[model samples]
Target: MNAHDPIRRCILLGERAPRESLIRLALSPDGAVFPDVRAKAPGRGAWIGVTRAELESAIAKGKLKAALARAFKTGPIAIPDDLPDMIAAALERAVLDRLGLEARTGNLLTGAEKIEAAARSGKLHLLLHAADAGTDGNRKLDQAWRVGKDEEGSDLRGLALPVPRTILAVALGRQNVVHIGLTERDAARRVSETLTRWLHFIGSHPALPTCETVSQGASALQIIPTGAGNSVADDDTCEELE
Candidate 1:
């Protein structure tokens, strides 16, 4: 765990972990259970330090309901039967929202040329590739990032986001967005953390084979391709690429 990530206790596992590593569940006044992917919801929240599969297993065995009841110290709370799907949707929205915010704030660079230029300049803190991005395109940008440097004077290693091109293009309000490079570490960290949580929530990370490996059949690539999901519709809040 990084020293910066706050430590929180998982009510179910009773283990201490980074706050960002745990999923937060909030309780409504009516005793409804809500997954707080951003951890921004109000009221007392319970933390869980389990992966998506573990969470689903717990829910299936009726263990999660008991754990939540214990954590909230209340009578049986209403947990939606489709709680996993709901949480997955919430996580997707949070990631897209963060991407949109980053684009609006000029902290994100899209398009192959712009992103590759930034990567080569050693100004890029993170590199995101759409799940459907062609292997050639991904390779070029990954090479640029390999030759780049971080702000701390260390070699930069590019990390691929699990989001698809459709979602990425919609989120950034750009046409055919296949690549994104984050210029600031803080912004990159925020996006990475959110993406990691989403991937974990969906049971995609550290378990399933990445899209890159499946597509290229080459172990040389460093990208971990994300699994497919429903597309997020475009919104007026996203600014068009200039």
Candidate 2:
């Protein structure tokens, strides 16, 4: 979504809310995802992340109940026992498991410097910009976008890197990339699924624009070292294709 554009505040809530039975919250905001730890019961939802502390804070402050009532413009409903933690853990595990799978498949790129190079190459179908990474890191890497050459072979610089917090970086990745990029068709599909969960569990945020391709050193990708596969230093981009 455009940064300045009004974010579509729709929620992608779960089929079952994290609350007592009969209580339900919808996750659609305007168009995409939203976290709703608070107000996740018996009414409309207030978006929240998949963090345990946030859930606890909501419970302690009564924010969870109040928000639900506020969203519904009604009275408060009871919060379920440990529902917040359960929800957060569930979300966290699901996110990490997916990332691990992608990592194993040679689809995912972790580590900042590694992806930074990828960002520069314009080879990225998606740049998994970390939600927690500072504005500067986000900006610098986002700068890697070189607009695609137009029909006249003139550089338009029109193309910007698509940075979707659109995807999630998780507590599991350990640092914070809950962020992920996608290039291949299958990987992109997994990215989409991950994106849906992010939207459903995490609230809306401004995502960066997308870039085209990143040129690598070799005409073909060579053998890449593990643990560095997600590294910007890895020179295996076209090698796999070759």
List lDDT for all candidates, in order.
Answer: 0.67, 0.40
Question: Candidate 2 on 1-242: residue-level lDDT in tens?
Answer: 11221111211121211121111234343322233322332323343333345456666877666555544443435566666555645554555566567766777775657665664564545555554456666554445533211122322121121333334433323445534555454564454444434333433322322222322211111222333323121211111111
Candidate 2: regions farther than 4 A off: 1-79, 111-113, 146-180, 205-242
| Positional deviation of residue 175's Cα in model 2 after best superposition, in angstroms | 8.1
Error of 2 at 188 (Å): 2.9
Which 10-residue window in model 2 sums to the lowest lDDT? 233-242
| TM-score, cand. 1 vs. native | 0.77
Write down the worst ten-residue block by lDDT for model 1. Answer: 232-241
- Provide the lDDT at 102 for model 1: 96
C-alpha-based local distance difference test score of model 1: 0.67
The per-prediction CA RMSD against the true structure, in angstroms, equals 11.7, 17.5
Kindly state the number of residue pairs that clash in model 1.
0
